[model samples]
Target: MTQTHIGVDISKDMLDIFDPRCGHRRIANTTAGIRRWLCGIGTDSFLVFEATSRCDKHLVAGAAAAKIPFVRINPLHGWHFAQSLNLPKTDRIDARMLARFGAERYPEPTLPADPARSDLAALSQRRDQLKRMETQEKNRLQDTSLAILQRDLRASLKALAVRITRIDALIRDHLRAHPQLAGQAKLLRSIPGIGPVTAVEMLAHLPQLGTVDRRSIASLGGLAPKARESGKFKGKRVLGPGRRHVRRCLYMAALAALRHPHLFGNAAARMRVAGKPGKVIVIAIARKIITIANAVLRDQTPFATA
Candidate 1:
C-alpha cells in the first residue's frame, strides 16, 4: 500500500504545506486550521515538520490528537537535506523537501509531547532566562563604578534573584504534582553530580534520555565526540552541535562531580596523570555524567558506588 507524506514549513502564524498528490498550499498555524488540514489528509499519512520552538505547538497537538504520525526534525537537519539536494531556500521548497525527506528517510514518528512535561519545560526555560539576566546584571555591576548605575544593577540583580527563587519553588511543586517526573528526578539526583536543577532540566528538556541508546542520548546532549579523520590525516575529535542548555547543565554537574573522589575524582585524576588538558578533562567528565544519567534512567535505578 502507498503511504502519503506531507511536509510542513511552520512559522509563528502560518504553515506552508506540500503533498505529492495535493501539491502546495498555505494555512494559518492555528488549532482550527491545523485540524482542517489534517482532516483533509487522513490518518494514514505522515506529517514532517521542523521543531520551530513554540510555533509548532499547535501543529504537534493537532497531529497527536488526530492520531497522525509525525517526525519533528531539527532545522539544521532539514537545511542539510536541502543542501544535499542543491535545492533553493523557500517556504514552499522547504515543505516539499521535507515531504521528500520523509518519504525517502522513513524516520520514526516522534512521541507526543506531554502537557505536564511541556509545562515543566516552559518553567525551566523561564528559569534559564532569569539566570542569564542575573549573570548579565552581575557582570554590569562589576564593571560599573558609577554609584547610580551600580544601584540600578544591584536592584535588578535582587529582583532577578527573587524571581529565580520563586521559579524554583514552582518547579518543585510541579514535580510533586507529577509523580513520573518526580520519580525520574529522584533517580537523576541520586547521582553524585546531578543536583535538583540539573534533574529538573533533564526531565523537562531531554525526555528521550532513558528511552534512547547511550550514544544517541550523548549526541542529543552534545557530549558525543565526533572524529575528524580522512585516510592518514586524523584530526582531533570534537563535539558536535546539540542542546547547548543541556550541555551547560552537564558541565556544571561535572564540576561538582569532581568534588567526589570516589565517583568522578579518580577518573579525573587518571586523565590528569595522562597529561590531558584541563578543559578536556572537564568535558570528558561532563560526557561521563550524561552517560551515567542515561544509564540510571534507562535502568530505572539510582547511581550506586558499591
Candidate 2:
C-alpha cells in the first residue's frame, strides 16, 4: 500500500505542516492540537519531522498514540535536503522540502521509546546538563581574579556538585526499579571501566545497542570512521555524526578502560606501537568498547577476557 507523506516543521509554540494533498497550514504545538491534526491522517501515513530538541516530543507521542508511522530526522539532514532545491528558507518551505525528502528517500520509521526508557532518558539528559553547568562554573572560577567573584563561583560549583550527586543517586534508584534496565546495566558494568554513568547513558540513549550489528552500533554512536574520496583524490576517514551524549559517555569509558591492562589497555598499547596518535588510539578504543558492549548485550552475557 502507498503511504501518504506529511512534513511537520515544529517550533516552540507552533507546528507548521505541509501535506502533499492538503498543502500548508499551522497549528498549536500542544498535545490537543497535535492529536487533532493526527486524527486527520490515516494509519498508512508517514510523518516526517526534524528533531527540535523537546519541542517534537508531543508530535512523536501523538503519532505513536494514533498508530501513525513517523520518523524524526536530524536538522542538518533536513537543511541539506532543502539546499538541493535552492528554495528560500521558511517554515512552510522546510516542511514541503521534508515531505519531498521523505517521499524520495523512503526512510524507515522509528518506534516510539518505551515509557520507562523515556523517563530514564529525561533524567540522564538532566544530569548531563547539571554537569555541564558545573564545569562552566568551575572554569569561570579559574579565570576570576576578584575575591568576591571567586567566592560566588566556588559556592555555585559546590551547589551544582551536590545537585549532580543527588541526580546520580536518583538515576541509580530509577534503574534499580526497572529490572530489565538493571540487568542491562549490570551486564554493561561487567566490563572494566564501564561505570554506572556510561551504562545508564547507553541504556537510555542507544536503544539499538544489542539489536543491531557491531558496525551499525559503532556508527550509531558516531565512532565509525567514514571514507572521504573524490574522482582522483582520497581524503582521510572521519567520524560522522551520531548521538553526541552516547558518544561522549563512551569516550570517557574508553579513557578509563585504557588505564586497565585487562580491559582495553592492551589494545591501546598495540595501537601505540603501530604509531597511532593518542587521540586516534582513544577513538579506536571507544569504538572497540562499544562493539564489545553490543556483543555482550546481544549475547546476554557478562564481559569475559576469554
lDDT (C-alpha, whole model) for all candidates: 0.92, 0.91
* Candidate 2 to truth, TM: 0.95
Error of 2 at 63 (Å): 0.6
Instruction: Please provide, for model 1 over 1-306, each residue's C-alpha lDDT reduced to its tens digit, 9 standing for 90 to 100.
Output: 667889999999999999898799999989999899888887779999998878998999999999989999888989999999999999999999999999999888899988999899999999999999999899999999999999999989999999999999999999999999999999999998899999988888898988888889989999888999999999999999888889999999999999997888999999999999998898999988888999999999999986
Of the candidates shown, which would achieve the greatest lDDT relative to the real structure?
A: 1
Worst lDDT 10-window in candidate 2: 260-269
Clash number by candidate, in order: 0, 0
lDDT of 2 by residue, 1-306 (tens): 999899999999999999988799999999999999889877878999998789998898999899899999989999888888888999998889989989999998988889999999999999999999988998899998999999999899989999999999999899889999999999999987799899999999999989999899999999999999999899989998998998999889888989986667778888899999998998999998899899999999999885
* Clash pairs for candidate 1: none
